[model samples]
Target chain A: MSGEMYIPTYQDMLDAHERIKPYIRETPVRTSAYLNELSGAELFFKCENFQEPGAFKVRGASNAVFGLDEEQAKKGVATHSSGNHASCLSYAAMKRGIPCNVVMPRTAPQAKKDTVKRYGGNITECDPSTSSREETFAKVQAETGGDFVHPYNDPRVIAGQGTCAREFMEQTGGLDMVVAPIGGGGMISGTCLTLSHQAPETQIIAAEPEQADDAYRSFKAGHIIADDAPKTIADGLLVPLKDLTWHFVSNHVTDILTASEEEIIDAMKLTWKHLRIVMEASSSVPLATILKNKDRFAGKRVGIIITGGNVDLDKLPWLK
Target chain B: MSGEMYIPTYQDMLDAHERIKPYIRETPVRTSAYLNELSGAELFFKCENFQEPGAFKVRGASNAVFGLDEEQAKKGVATHSSGNHASCLSYAAMKRGIPCNVVMPRTAPQAKKDTVKRYGGNITECDPSTSSREETFAKVQAETGGDFVHPYNDPRVIAGQGTCAREFMEQTGGLDMVVAPIGGGGMISGTCLTLSHQAPETQIIAAEPEQADDAYRSFKAGHIIADDAPKTIADGLLVPLKDLTWHFVSNHVTDILTASEEEIIDAMKLTWKHLRIVMEASSSVPLATILKNKDRFAGKRVGIIITGGNVDLDKLPWLK
Candidate 1:
């Protein structure tokens, strides 16, 4: 499974869905008439924020955890994530009654660290840099002999994330286009994988923060653009796209759009105010881009994937 | 309909459900595993906050606005409310293409006023006192000859609000008890009206803020006890129970509970952090009471009605 990059097929996603059914929620899709009127598009929100662990990453994490063989499961699963992925993996591992180890940035939000700890995941902190994360994660994995589940790069994770798109399409009947926030491109790549097969006509759009516009730049340059410790209010979207996710993003994504940090924050507030849901700044990227590029989405049936809702209530970006 | 106090029967609720089906939302019910574990109860949250107008009052507002005769409709509808009821009534009036005259305190939250205006309701500001409000409302009603839609005291409104409990029962199969915040007792009265007949075994509990515990005092004293002006973070629950609402409260409510201002605020933040939904502090009272009195609710299947979500994002209670 590790020699060459293994590309997951549609059948893989179908199989993952059945495997994770007991652990993941088929979260409800919500709509806002006011938002529809403002955006000039009929919008459907796939509320992954409503997931039990409060994120869509659970789908992929559950797939990877449950898919492991009994021998491999005993060693448990490990990942390096600064946010939702770390906690989601921990949650999945806890459900399967196995130990989970996480390598996270020392500076990650306390709320995120609390979630991972609450789920009984052992956390080893690393400096907030790619080199330090990899180095720390390597040592942790070697010591524990745990299965490494890459947050977005692995085939099993991407296929697991693809199930969200399948549910979204079924819930909305069919959409003209689907928009999702892109960081490592896991959710976007998964959306592309599902729509490219099930509903080819539905365009896949990736939204990114202008502060961390690596994905947008990569799409324009036709090559991955890795950033060095990029900073943004959308902390979840700081990572660069990996080769496996890049393959789908380069081939299937119709376009990659970027929104300013202010726009992202504003959209987050607008969604909370109008849609009446508590979601993270990262999840607001898609809506920010859609509102900024209204002409592109006007009068279309658009599906927006709300990736997660895990945020610090006391220190909201707007208040800060 | 006006001579004697008409109690809304179960049949009235059934009819109201059908009549307002097109105008209101059958808002989704949500559950939180974390909250369930913390409270020692299986809790179902009937998210009235998800309504298009962002409240359960829309059901009652829609019932009154749409059930009017053509002669009364031509004159339009009027109400005086400081919060969700104003916006919700305006929303219903706009749907029926009738003029909605809202008499509101000049100091009502700007967010609330904006909503009523956005829904095409005319706002006639009055002083923040019962006498001033009634005097101003009387002048406005006389000038327009509009029918007054009492926020909770009207039979039509009570029947309409009862539909929420009907949906709650259907969504949860059945619950051991249902808890709702008692403002003017509109929502609580409606819950009692529905459960008293539809699911007679289900107990109806009313929650109130300790700061403004008129309902709690009234229940204990075996009579009405109105507060001239009670201050609390739960601004929605400041109003006293009217005669019609009192009738249901005295006859059917199992018990009334109260929570401190700090407790209500903490519960509001906890709900937003865990349930991932934006709801008013007023709606947090039920959960606050449940958390405070865990022994009474342990091992019970309880339904908590999330009354509304029209809060100023810039001024969250916890942030303040």
Candidate 2:
């Protein structure tokens, strides 16, 4: 599956949406008058956080697991993720009655690990570094003889992620622009994939934490950039963009923006206070960028994809 | 308006629904599979907390504000509340381009006061005690000539709150029982008012904090039990039931259950962690009682009213 990179087309996304519909929630879209007033934009939040697995990655994970042919289903699926993707994949696999193996950083939040285990995913821990994660994942895949489902790089996963944009477009009618946090670029790439076909006039923006700005740097430099172990409180977004995600990011994303750690935390707390929903810090990057760049978004109908809500309640960033 | 006790009828509730339709949100009902598995009950959460003013009170507040005649509308509306009602009333009045006067205990959470002010409500501070609040409110009302809208006791307000149950029944098709926290008994009374007419077979259960269980005592003693100042982490349920609310509680309520402060806090955090919604501790009482009396709700369809989401994020009860 990794030899030659295949870009997921709009048809693949449409098919993925139909395949994953039974397994995923077409989560509700939420709006905050306070946030709209503050940003001077009509903001619509596609609440993927409210998904049963508490993340949008479930859309992609379910697509990958259910799309498996009967023969390939016997091998099950495997992936390495710092948080949501691992648990989401396990959830999808469990629903399909297939074994799921996850290689996770030892330092991943205990809450995340608990969720993965709850979904019956077998966990093999690796060091927190990227090199250690890749090396450990390779060994696990070989030993388990599992089908590798890369967290964000696989065409199946990206196509699955694109389903969110399809729902967002239907729910909001149309939007001037869509903003999403870019980690490994799975969500953003998916947004680009669907919107490029369905709402070509709509601009796509990728938000990144300044502390881990590989995606933002790549967009500006006109090439892919890899960050080994960038540090940020938005743990879900530390990975570098791969070739498949880069294909969409490079072509369809109109802009890449970065926000400070402090701004991201502030935006997160503000959402919890006003929007009244618990969401991860990584999801806050888009709001932080919008707040910082109000003129760019003001008076426009904006769609912000809230990626996930799986946070360790005891270890909230602001509490420290 | 206070001379003879007026009972709100089912027709009044139907009328209130139409009056408030443009101003209030028909909040979505949320379900948690994890919670359903734990309680052995199919629980449907009518998320009133997602209301724009962050409370179910907006339904009643909007009804009262919009039902006014031209001369009465000029006078505007007033209410004395410890928290949510003050802000909600202010929000409703602001929408109609009318004045909203609020009599609030100076001791109310600053977050609540800020919300009231943000909605352009004129606030008159009073002492924390019930007597002081009423005394101050009388003077303020006399001076301003504002129409008094009781937090939970008025027929107009009860009729307005009844609309929630109407939507709940429509949303869930039907439920075996409906549970809500008993504060001034406004919400519970409203539930009884609607269900007695719409779905008479559905049981109405009221949950109360044991520390401030005046409603529970009142239910047992067959009379009103007023507690001047009761202490509990659930600040919303401290008020005693008034005559209009007492009428419904005595006739229609199946039971009044109480939960310990610790149990309420635990349920609040559990909902936050699993349901991923920011809600007030007051809203957790229903879940607390449901957990304690699992056998009563087991295998039955239960509707839980999430009363409000106006909390001081800086001082979450569990964190303290």
Candidate 3:
């Protein structure tokens, strides 16, 4: 495997911004005095939860699929997931009229599967574990001759993820800090890469839910930590840091912070209450961090990348 | 009572828009292929849920409060509501550094009271079922010598509501149909007024929940209907339609449509899921109608006014 930065340069992000212009939405840069006062920070929300596929995964997946050559495209695209990435890839492939095969964990919630099916993806469910999903995906890719798109740890994927940060920085000039929840390093790594160059003054913050703090631990240890066992309301943040994402984040990101389960739930409700933006627990990572570390961010210009809105209602902890 | 068109002219709406520009948000227009496809309509959601005080009611409240003379401003403004309008009036008054009084039903959600208090408004509560919140508001006004701003039946308020349609049509050219939820009929009447004169080609739809079908009954009768009991999941739509709002709706609005409780819940959830914006049951009314009457809207451009996001999470049906 290539040890080099998987993502292309800032110039590539600029180019992707143009290439995906026809497809990706330039989501709103939202602000409020109410939120500002609560956080003690001047906040700008780069609402990727409002993105076309209801997640930033679309940005990377769309770019990867569309950037492919006709010969490669004819092979179609394949992935392994049962979350936003699967649906995003499925939707993006369907948009280009390419067949999509997704190998999902058998234990993946039905909501995610239903959404993927809505976009006409063929789903193969295996054992509820990474080894099984990966093995099934490899077999499927071999069977269909489909191009495999990694969820976060690929060059094309990271390049696409960087586009969100590039657009965000352009929308709100010179942010003092940028915050986002870290699951795998796909979002924050690309975010770090983009903000490191475009708005060099901006500090990058990786927010992680405490119940699933693999990234936080990895940052502290200066190495990658792949979490095999996980339990959290934020299902999206359950994935541990991968090698490429680890390298990307270690070089570009400045700090990582954690929020407790209670904090995650509170922040989720707060986002719903104030912004009218319904987000899953993973999306609340920023709000949870901000609320927990108010002193660190007071009076600074902050931008939060809300990742997605795909939440399982039955699993919502606040349904009391 | 003035037997007149409360919001009599388009200019009033324009003036209100300009006056409230500093405080009120010109909320974004959200478009979702998923929503448009589901409803069988090309939809542009004018998101007033992001507006100041979390509702369109702020526009009128801001206009009325800011337009007052110095002596009148010193006396301040007062209103009665169990929901959005109370917060809207309080917020507008606070922005002008004026004292605001809100008389609400004691049964008003604790969330609304908390927000009003947070904004520093004086509150008076009375029985909502057995007694009139309006009569209490009048008493509060009489004692305080403040001007009474009727929730929806006021001229300045209707003018404020009209601004939504003005911005909607301005942002996206000539909508084929404009749909808004009707409670006291302020939003529909004002939106219809703007559409009738400015974009005459556009048809107006008033979305009313089946449980509270006053607007539907009024439309069928070809005259204003009042002196009736009201009930609905859309709490904001329970108030009887006023005479002034009736006249405007009768003349300009094409029809009134009703949605079931399940439709309202699903539509509300869909709006939050797709738009990532919070909307109350009242705010969901227009979306509910589109989903209910899918045949009329296929392939046609339509505008849906998301009225407000002032919902109490503690009172959420999902919690139950």
Name the top DockQ candidate. Answer: 1
- CAPRI category for model 2: medium
Off by over 4 Å in 1: A1-3, B1-3
What lDDT does candidate 2 reach at residue B110?
79
- When just chain B is superposed on the true chain B, each candidate scores a TM-score of 0.98, 0.97, 0.95
Q: After superposing candidate 2, which stretches have Cα over 4 Å from the reference?
A: A1-3, A129-132, B1-3
User: lDDT tens string, model 2, A205-285?
Assistant: 999999999998898999998886799999889889988898899999999999999999999999988889999999999
What is the DockQ score of candidate 1, to 2 decimals?
0.90
- Compare the candidates by lDDT and give the number of the best one: 1
Q: Candidate 3's residue-wise lDDT over B1-320, tens digit each?
A: 75444446888878888888898888899999888778888999999888757898888788888989999999998877777888888899989999999887888778789889988899998888545765786689899998888888888888888888998988997799988998889888788777888998898988998888877887898776763777678988888777778779888888889999888888887877777777888988888888878899888899999988888766665545
What interface RMSD does every candidate have? Answer: 0.7, 0.9, 1.8
lDDT of candidate model 2 versus the reference = 0.92
- C-alpha lDDT of all candidate models, in order: 0.94, 0.92, 0.84
Q: What is the TM-score of chain A alone in each candidate?
A: 0.97, 0.96, 0.96
